[model samples]
Target: MAILKHVAGKSADYGAALDYLKYEHDEVLKKPLLDANGNWVLRRDILLDGINCEPELFDVECEMLNAQYHKNQNYDEIKTHHYLISFDPADKDECGLTGERAQAIGMEYVKTNFPGHQALVCTHMDGHNGSGNIHVHIVINSLRKLDVPQKSFMERPIDCKAGYKHHLTKDYLKHLQQSLMNICMRENLNQVDLLSPSVNKITQQEYYARQRGQINLDKLNAELIAEGFTPMRTKFQTEKDKLRDSITAAAKRAKSFEEFSRQLQAESGISVKDHRGRFSYLLPNREKYISARTLGTSFDRNHLLMLFESNALTAEREKQQWSVADPIAVLYIKSNLRLVVNLQDCVKAQQSRAYAQKVKISNLQQMANTIVYIQQHGYDSYDELKKARDELSAKMSDARNTAKSTDADLKRLNEQIHYLGQYLSTKATYKEFLQANNKKIYRSEHQEEIAKYEEAAQFLKRSSPDGTIPTMKDLRAEKEKLLSTRAVQYESYAYFKDYYHELQTACQNVDMILDTGHTQQHSRTHPKRSHEPSL
Candidate 1:
């Protein structure tokens, strides 16, 4: 994918930034190539139109412009703005774009977007870690040298002579991104949709850590194996991954922003801080925080607000429906409260009109009788209803755990059976491999087969004290035995599945009974009195 990386930084000394780009010193290099003092290697360097300087005189020309036109005399003040525009590395050979062609694209980009600025648009061939991605460095003097056309900055007319400074905004950045995409498309080069929804944006810190092979779990597992210790499952999920999954799940389940935020904190132990208009998630253990946009598009500030608005509209419509809904219809919906909470169930319920009608008919008759029973016995208090729901939820949780455990056992057993079968099938190949061990020559095609059998044999030896290799007949018998046991185990596990469904239905029934035709309020003061009817 063609990633448009935009890094903007102000520097008092423009030459330093220019030198860093041209010098080619990075962690990937075995030795820093800074021996050449002033003469740095550059693939292509060109000054834009109106910049009266050759590529060779880049430093002197920029210094002169800063000294003459720039009003701020302070040496520390930012006199130059640097930007990076890059493309995917594979584009070079794939798109047939030479270094000169890439430079032309960069030059055109600067001329089109950053007009009226004395800019040195330089294209570099050696990317980070020798990735070979052709990237452009657009170093422009902050002081404008010509009248920027109204088309470039539509908000206000730029008069370079009147000391008007160039301004960049989010919208302008997006516009420039679009222009780059267009340029790539027009020139028949490799391109990516820069405007696509950015779900996961990896930061520089994570990128460098991965490059350095500093991630712990992977290294730990390899070390454990090397030391003859069986490596257990490594909990490799970082705090960020957990937080992202939690937020994404909550966002999907929550009906409103308030509910999403509340559920996210309650479930994930991550507190949300909304300062000014930006949103950030603060991890409990870490002082560092991540922005909402950094998480994904679904968690963006604007998107969350839009979701809140949408949910509010939905609630309003539901409230209106509740006011005039038929008693049977209300009862039917109340009986399916579990469906309301489960997106998958709700989708299944809406899959077909006939199935939905069938559900309604079933709920209506049962609910009609339940409503009569509730009227005769008086309503169940909020606390009583909540207790019943909680009890059912507990049962469902236990049942789900049991099912998951059984499924895991089945999977492990199946994997073992498969490995044993493979080992038995490759016995002949293993004998051949043993003979080839001392031989000077062996067939290359048989190496893969030999390796697989060898790995299985070693694993089997580690598992068994005598290193017993099961015969094909024995392996088949064991597999058949496991299949038979699985059938019986599955039959037993069917009860938990049924139990979960029954508990969900019961919980939904209780919610239906409590939520309909009642204004129940909850309070901490006088528990019994608090549960009294609000109607």
Candidate 2:
């Protein structure tokens, strides 16, 4: 995950920011909250507010602030924070930990390492990355207590040190790193060093310039051309002939060292040996040997010379151009369409299972109620009641299976939807390519197909008797209805089952109680006869 740090306030020093960032790291309960772009965005401001509030008052005050912000902005208040450390979720594993959990872990780590400082940790999950990564945001409060003296906020604050102005210094950054390292060591987590921030160091142009200087494009093109081969610029290719022409032109322009060699090999069947004992196509009548630098490429003569001597260039080029017009593109498009289909299938499966679960739960509830009614009528020991209890138990097991199957179907449906989303995103370019090639035909076909599938999927999305996808409240109502039905069935089964067991236990107890009472009565009536016993 990529980690980013930003400082707030015009006069903010690195030290103060670092201290605040560290404190925020410790105080926030969840890590890496996702933003609209699906990147992890953590705010330091909310963390600082959380830390400054009394422990008992933190949650309530935060909730009120959040509520007020939402009422005004319709979004979370944390987005308004001045300082933030954002993380990219593409770098993380699929543990499904939410932003809250990330914040909690980060905060706990900081609290254990740094004693008195207050911090807010925000964690986020971002789906924007090619590989989803989880990121954490740690925000710390820069200002220390005004009344506190001598001791830095890094140490435990005494009762007398309630209102001191604590300023963060550059040295505090060092302390922050040490604390983070300590936590990492204790927890066996990966350690990162932010002492020298890498983001602000270089410009993109400078990096590109350096990269361009390392490649000898001119020499490579010439060599390929001389071997009766052409350099194809796959990026701009529209047709096969165009690709062939582009390669032919580069071969004919044999002015540089590489180009001359390439042309000579194409024209004359001559091969020559270099100083390094590498074989290259030699000039027909020229006595002097040409080095790669004569072509003005920026590599060492030996390295440039090696290209002509090697056969691996063709293989590498082929690999690079593999996806330019391959069948894989078509296959990917088909796969994406299949995914859309699968999602429809899943929705249907989930709907069917949900209905089945509702029915089974209802049946179980009814059976439970029936058993309870029988026991209540003083027919507790009836043989028919025992048989009904056993039958109901068997039915209940079937209902449980139905519920489990419904959960599985729902999970599958969700997974299919997620996969379809990913497939659409990844193959977006291919779809565009197809449209560009056959605009009217492809559009008409895709539009019709998509419309049909959407209609079918919509049916499964319905959550009410009106055949509409229900809102949260509507869904809840449906759930309650099913649950209420199930509850009644369960009550009947439980009542009868419990009654049957109770009767058996009572019968045994009664037999013992009567025997003891009879013996006691006999003893009272005739003491000698009681001892002698009437066989």
The number of the candidate with the highest TM-score is 1
| Model 1, backbone clash pairs (residues 3+ apart or across chains), number | 0
Over the stretch 405-523, how does candidate 1's per-residue lDDT look in tens digits? Answer: 66676565566566777776786875665567653355465777767777776776565445554444444444554555656556544544454454445446656545532423443
- Candidates' TM-scores? 0.48, 0.24
lDDT of 2 by residue, 1-535 (tens): 2333333333222233333333323222223455688754453323222454443343344344434434222232122223233333422343344556556656665455333434455444542222344555554433222242343435444322432222344675556555555654454444566564342232333334433432445566565467433453212222222222322343334334465345434434333344464423234455554433332222223434444344356655665577474422111211100000121224454567675555445544544443454455345554654454455455456556555655554554554444344433434543453447776765575665444444433443442234333233223333443554556656544544444444333333334345546867987986564444221
Point out the worst 10-residue segment of candidate 1 by lDDT. 328-337
The lDDT per prediction is 0.61, 0.41
